[model samples]
Target: MPLKLQSTFPALSLFGVLATLLSLPGLFGCQFPPKIDHGRYTKLFSIFSTEYKYECDSGYTLVGEEKISCSDSVWSPAAPQCKALCRTPEIANGKLSVYKIHYIEPETVTVQCNTGYGVVGSERITCLENRTWYPEVPKCERKILAGCEQVLAGKHLMQCLPGSQDVKLALEVYKLSLEIDVLELERNKEKAFQEP
Candidate 1:
């Protein structure tokens, strides 16, 4: 009876050791949590009641819960989703050269004002990671041309004008000639005053 009791005792000890080793993982929370797409987690173990924080990658925004806690070997509140978005920019008196009507993050667009309007900001804008444009939206303002500048611009336009299209060119030339005549009269008046 003593020999049988010794053998049974050794067997019981071995079984106890095996059970403890098997349960060690549960005690230390050794299970790995599920991966979150487009995001990363901070905690190594997903033990019960352990919280894990998640962050989205560049050009992606987190949606739903930012942190999830493990419960019953499963993450609660589910993993947050990373969504990409790009807000469309608004520009007054200007137009954007975008390939897609719906904008996306990290995309580039060219901004230009209409004819006779001046741009007050950057001509190119890039979508940022936060779904906002890097530079502020450009503004287009009506160009106020000086009298001489208008005449000069008109002369340049005339150079490009076809010979057959004379109506518009002739009108601009007539206006310039009238301006020249008025300047000559003013000069003559100044000359008369100097002589006296």
Candidate 2:
């Protein structure tokens, strides 16, 4: 009996075998695993304290944390949340612009009045590590002017009345005359001490 010989696998035959093996999955009666829909799995995954990233809806903002990671295929207890952050207070007239932190934690803003007004506390106070304002709430009050009695001998005299103005003017004139007399006396003494 003559022995039948088998053909050796060549370059073309190797390629054909590979193609058949790869196509066999789709050709034969085989089924792939069901794909997981992210939306449907979202609620199921939320039960676990797994770190996740969630997008906020329009018109709504996200605060606190935005992203987190899961370890051991489980979310951490410190899950990131989306909260509303406090907005910066409206700046009043003659007030400086304080930093408005929408993403960060709440902060306090202190306003300082112009030079004419007296600032009750710090001009610009902000929240410290404790989330509390340094100076709390500050106020601005108008500076008080000195009264007539508080004025010095010839300082800041208002000309409210003509009679009072005349008296103030006379006092000023007498003070000027006294200064002139003193200067004259000093000159006379200096001349007397000078050599001939």
Candidate 3:
């Protein structure tokens, strides 16, 4: 009978290296390395040779290579920056639901237009992996009201305006009150005639 030797050794491939580093994850650093804003380099992992790497923080991604080389105490190709996946853009006459200053990759946000305004584009946008927001932010446009000003402010108008419901509601209440007064007057008149 021939004895077989099973290889229990783990692979040191890119994923294996990363997985090993992930086990001890918290923060990373490199000796005498270039400073990258919103970014950090992973621990030195050895295969054929030891190396330094880079990764970005939450809501940011590297713009250049993740692996950097140090020669003669100088970093080659420069250190990549951790760019924001998406910046909270200002929506004129509208508002975004996200309260964060910046958003991470794959995050989506919903936009809402103020009263008396209509949206001109998609109401939602997603943060793409390419460090950009998919589909530009939507714009809010004030609807044209041909006779909005002409309509009395005390009643419902054809043009959609803020507080229009309140105005129409008040008008309805006023009409009902007048109707009650007329009915009461008529009842009094009939009673007076009968008394005479």
What's the lDDT for all of these models?
A: 0.72, 0.49, 0.70
Clashes per candidate, residues 3 or more apart or on different chains: 0, 3, 0
Tens-digit lDDT string for candidate 3 (1-87): 233322323333556777666443222323556778778887476533335699988878678878866544456667787777778
lDDT computed for candidate 2: 0.49
Ranking by TM-score: 1, 3, 2
Model 2 — TM-score against the truth? 0.33
Pairs clashing in candidate 3?
A: none
lDDT of 2 by residue, 64-150 (tens): 344444444333333443333444444443464565554233444558677767767677765443334555546677666674333
Poorest stretch of ten by lDDT in candidate 3: 1-10
Candidate number with the higher lDDT (1 or 2): 1
* Candidate 3 wrongly placed segments (more than 4 Å): 1-41, 44-54, 57-84, 145-196
TM-score of each: 0.39, 0.33, 0.38
Stretches of model 2 off by over 4 angstroms after superposition: 1-69, 73-78, 81-84, 90-93, 97-103, 106-110, 121-136, 145-196
Write candidate 1's Cα lDDT for 62-171 as tens digits.
77788876556556787877766676677778888864544655678998889989888888888765667778878888887776665676667777767856857677
Q: Model 2: which ten-residue window has the lowest total lDDT?
A: 32-41
